[model samples]
Target: MYDFQKTQLEFIEHIKDPDNKPFKHPVESRRMDIYRDLFFNNIKGFLSSGFPVLESLYNEEQWNSLARQFFATHDCRSPYFTDISKEFVEYLSNEYELQAHDPIFMKELAHYEWMELAVSIRKQTQKWDASKTVSNVQMSQLASVVSYQFPVHQISQDYQPTEPSEAIYLVIHRDSDDKVDFTLITAMTAHLLLTIENNEQLSIDSLNTMMIESLPQLDAEQVIQGIKQIVEQMIAQEILVPYSISE
Candidate 1:
């Protein structure tokens, strides 16, 4: 390899893991120290802001140690700072082994927090049509339906759960006002949203048929009524938006 490329690799290694990878290139120690601190601090700050609840559960020393480990270990795919939270969520989900002090809900909570950031920043291509009927609909681009074994939305320093609760479902969405919020939803609502998301477009009658097929024990008329109410509520929240088959 060329000398410049080798030096660049060494520089990055030292920045990521200053404790072990010595900066072998003849750079001054003070300058190398500044680079290392600046890079690590940027990552740490993003993580703290992205997962405030997760950060709150840890002491300063523990949080820094966790952030440092992620910095040294994870290979982030995106180059943008806004993407760091997503990378951190991926790291927690796939790479990092849970330490004793790490909360069991760490992965779920991190993902929940990341979803809020993601929904807030997502670009919406389709304009909302208030005049469209609720018969035809699609899941909003700015919304997501997620389920977790723990109540990640309720997790905090004072309310940490040691044992997993019943599976909880949530619909996190960015509204027309560009405000991000989450609504705790029943499993049926989550299922309906996911079905709409996967299918691209569905009508209230079609959804009722699907639900009736899945749940034969329920009366057909009652199922239809329930689905209509659900669709109307979702449309009101802008979680489900009108879509024509042609579009």
Candidate 2:
């Protein structure tokens, strides 16, 4: 009798290889072809939705070529269909780069575009504190939050007319409603968020003082207001979970 597991593995290998001898279906060869086509088309459709902008950027030939390459190279770990996009994005980050003069902005553009789906699927585990004091609070030590080096916020695949003269900054987080929100943030704001994540004990006033010195363009009032706005939004969206209130 055939070892079911080994037989299944052999069948999978056969299906993946166009050169391999076809599996003898009890029914007919045409049925096997139909199955093969269905498998390939389903994966293609899933990838297309995951990387819409990337698909639009490249011609059909180029897009298919990349997809084939991705399929062959990456050993996806997730069994769930929804996680495939995350795996594809991870592949791009590790293995792909824009061709010479192709578009310096391509990498960031892909990242910015991918964030929509990434944030939508992200599972948040930490609880945030709403009443925590902001003044003099240490702002550098939160792990749940993510920060990126690229100025990805400026390029809009849909709206922007001309390329930007300067780099952009962005922050992406899941709100309370389970919706992903992307916001353009300043270097100081980014730094402040990082500080909060890093330091166990921080004061709100000290954070403000640091922001004023770190970002010379913004005055104290503007910085304070900006922080307040972000905090409120974060709280409402559930990005900032309630931890503990200070006395």
Candidate 3:
């Protein structure tokens, strides 16, 4: 290995985790400390902003510990600063070891928060004509349907629940005006959205029929009316866009 390359790797390792990976290279302690603080603080600041709710649930020391763990261990793949939050979410979902102090809903809450940021910055590839009454409907690129065991949307420092509740469903979407918001939805609505999202060229009428068949206990007319209402509401919120058959 090249001398300079080895030195560079050692420097990064020390900066990422000073406590464990001590700097063995020829560098002044003051210089290394400055670099360590700069790098760690930058990462910590972004995490604090990205997961404000999660941060609030912990004390400053606890939050810093969590952030440092992510910095020291997770191998982030994205080069963009905006993607750090996503990397943190990935770490929580796949890599983080649950500490007893950690909330049970930590992973879900992190995901819920990240989705808001993700939807806000997501780029739109195609424009929709809201006036067009197209038969086929598809979920918008900027919209996401999520289900969690806890009511992630309602969780806060004062109201953290110890036990999981019934599965909660939510739809997060960005409107044409570029405002991001989420709506609490029923399990049935969640099912309908997922069905549309997974299928191509599925019309609302077809979905209504499928729902009626699946939920035979409900009156057919009532099911049709409920689906119609949900479809209209979703269209108005830009969660469901009119899909053009030509495309």
Task: For each candidate, give its TM-score against the true structure.
Answer: 0.96, 0.66, 0.93
lDDT: worst 10-residue window of model 3: 126-135
Instruction: Quantify how close model 1 is to the true structure by its C-alpha RMSD in Å.
Output: 1.3
Across 1-247, the per-residue lDDT of candidate 3 in tens digits comes to: 6988988898899899999988886788888778999999999999998999999999988999999999999999999999999999999999998999999999999999999999999998855754567677888899999999998998999989889998889999999999999999999999889888988788777888888998999999999889888988998889988877677
> Model 2 — which ten-residue stretch has the worst lDDT?
135-144
Q: lDDT score, residue 2, model 3?
A: 100
Query: Candidate 2: lDDT over CA atoms?
Result: 0.61
CA-lDDT, candidates in order: 0.88, 0.61, 0.91
Q: What TM-score, to 2 decimals, does candidate 1 have?
A: 0.96
RMSD of 3: 1.7
Best candidate according to TM-score: 1
Better of 1 and 2 by TM-score: 1
The alpha-carbon deviation from the true structure for residue 158 of candidate 1, after best TM-score superposition, in angstroms, is 0.8
Candidate 3: Cα lDDT at 1? 64
Off by over 4 Å in 1: none
Candidate 1 residue-wise lDDT, 87-106, digit = tens: 99999988899999999998
- lDDT per residue for candidate 2 within 1-247, as digits (tens), equals 4677766766665455434445553547777678666765667788899767657767777776677666656778999888877778787778876564234555555666677777777665554554545343332111134344444554445643235454455667666566666767665556667766665555556656666777788777998787778655545544444444353
- Rank all candidate structures by their lDDT, best first, as comma-separated numbers: 3, 1, 2
Better of 1 and 3 by lDDT: 3
Q: What is the lDDT of candidate 3?
A: 0.91
